[model samples]
Target: MYQTDNLKQKIKLFMIIFFPILITQVSLNLMTFFDTVMSGRAGAEDLAGVAIGSSLWVPVFTGINGILLAITPIIAQLLGAQEDKSIKQKVQQAMYLSVGLAIAILLLGLILLNPILNTMDLEYEVRHIAKFYLITLGVGIIPLFIFNTLRCFMDALGQTRMSMIIILIALPINLLFNYIFIFGKFGVPAFGGIGAGIATALTYWVISLLAIAILYKVAPFRDYQLFSSWVRPRVKEWLEQLKIGVPIGFAIFFETSIFAAVTLLMSAYSTNTIAAHQAAMNFSSLLYMIPLSVGMALTITVGFEVGAKRMQDAKVYGYIGISGGIFIALFNGIVLFAFNDYVAGLYNTDPDVIALTVQFIGFAIVYQLADAFGAPIQGALRGYKDVNMTLVIALVSYWVIGLPTGWILANYTSLEPFGYWVGIITGLSCGALALLARLIHIQKKYRNQIENSSAT
Candidate 1:
């Protein structure tokens, strides 16, 4: 009874943190959805332009964010150790890093823009519009990174509601801007999809500035004095963040790129196939937010406990997070599976797209549990600062094993798109199992270290 009660309490705590983060994530995604929808109304060419631009930007942006994600656990650990004095310095260095990296990314994007577009063989109009969109959006990258840096800092300290509220405020603002700019409302020139990019860029600046103000002026955060003084960037601290962050960045890149690759590969099939795949992927991605949020909360909790030198408690929290994630996954899987047709219909009215989407959803259902397991385990690893192995596992599981199997099944066999999804299932399962094993091994290793220290 005690164990059960403890698990319930832990789960409750996890949810308390998870839901707000989940809402923030959903709001961010909704911003993108609004951009896409509004751009689509402009024209097919405009839509394709935004889509192509997004494909280029999303991976790079996601990679940068992943790298910065290291700060979350680092901050959590600092707070856990009650080393509040050190927090400002670390955040300052992170701010410097974020700005520097953002500028570099922008320059790189500019340098690579023409070359990358040339290789895509896109229609001239599409290519031209995409170039404009990229350039416009590129201007916002710095603010985006800055916002993310402060957001991570706050979330690590368990101040999620503020960030969530800020993001919520931005969503409607983003839509209003998108409408005005995309349609040239109130005398604004119709920049079409490029206008959407402009609106998003402007939104980034707004949100980042708001976040900065909140961190500096908000009552809960005022005592931290996060911006009290700028610290010169130290090589050792930057290296430390890179050591933990680069692998995480690559891990995220690998996962997102694989899905992108699959979508590109599916282009070889019928338009209906592509549409169906996208519909299924969209819904599945939304469902994924649940576990992702829980996983992030677990990272903070476990990192805090570990920093406090409470390894057993960390382990307990890790298990509770994993268990909670699995339960959520089970529930999502059943709902998605049972309502596949009905849900797919929500995205499209075409009978063919609907049928194909339902079929794809079936595969998503099978792997939902694996996804749930893998994501939280990864989070737990991050909390323990055990991140390098995750990159290796992801590489082997997704590329070496999963992608090849998928390619062969997709190309050599009649399974086609279904085969690719099967590969996803295999990869996710392998990743989940591998991550679980690593978590167990690390827990035992930490326990032994503590035991030895005590005995000595």
Candidate 2:
């Protein structure tokens, strides 16, 4: 394992892992950013449709993808323990699980998606765009799931720069496709917001193919023979991973679904309201990538430390990650506060849209610090494999506390859409505090166990 005793050494190793992951994360999110921007340019209806479609898609994607995410820490810990023999088999099993989950999600979408959209009071264009956007996006689901499994494997191995490079290659292709489809370049029909879906779906395939090639061709990766040495699907291994994955999946789902729920709620309001909300949200999500990357980095770093029985080193990584996340959020807040209008304008030029987006960004500013605080700790806890509490915390803090507060405030008072933002801020703050306390308890418990063992 890398040196963890020296603060500088730890920080150096952290950065080595962090920077590529940061670029990879931010670049991936930029796909959404481009989608929103390009769709917004197409028209308000286009933007709203894509936004609504995304609201539905994101939670499902992340929740299921979160299951695949377990491979990262699982492999990281295995690496730390120098247990390399089972690595290839574990990844193969994860691939099988990813395929199964993708099939399940697809079936669910077919059964439930249209009904859910139908229940929402959306504009005709918005509804049409949203429906087709999801359908088009669906074509890529299997590949995307496969790709993410590969990504988690690579990330766990700390081959993040390779992931970063693959995504960077995909980004421009996504952009080009989005333009061609959205604007009807060459022979393609104008798809508007649905084109963004087509673009994203195609991008998923591209990245997945690229990732596979890398695994096949790369030195250390090829040594694992990820493709040739496929392991048969075993229920026992699947259950073991699902044990780790399901809570992580649900915790991510709960948090993401809160935002989706809020967006769905906003459907009752004007299309302009939904557009403005989405614009602010897209920009905020872009900024969120910073702390989020920190959190992701922590998962690998701290997981390795904990797996190596270095409790203090794990704690140090957690502290550094959490502190750095909050500090970066503060810096993001300053940027948002100073240039809220400019950022809002990037999404749309409609005066009302820009104005409301600016207002929502204000709410975002208030919560940046809290979001930063919570996210990294969540990552840290995952490193410790204390995910059940993370799931409970997310459920209560987001659904029980946050969503309800937003609903009441939006309906019972004049806050409306802004009220939802307030609720998000409240939930994030609560989750942060709860997670911090949980991390402390887990750390102490592990430390005591280790100490007692040493004494004996």
Question: How much does each candidate deviate from the true structure in C-alpha RMSD?
Answer: 3.0, 0.9
Q: Put down candidate 2 lDDT per residue, 1-456, tens digits, no spaces.
A: 364669999998899888999999899999999999999999999999999999999999889977998998999899888899989999999999999999998899999988998999998999999999999999999999999999999988877888899999999999999999998999999999999999999999999999999999997799999898567899999998999899999999999999999999999899999999999888888888898889889999999988888999999999999889878988999999999989999999999999999999999998777888898998999888889999999999999999999989998889977999999999999999999999999999999999999999
Error of 1 at 117 (Å): 3.2
lDDT tens digits, residue span 299-344, model 1: 8888988888888888998988888788989998998988999977
In model 1, how large is the Cα lDDT of residue 107? 84
Q: lDDT per model, in order?
A: 0.83, 0.92
Ten-residue stretch with the least lDDT total in model 1:
1-10
Best by TM-score: 2
Clashes of 2: 0
Error of 2 at 89 (Å): 0.2
TM-score, every prediction: 0.92, 0.99
RMSD from true fold, candidate 1 = 3.0
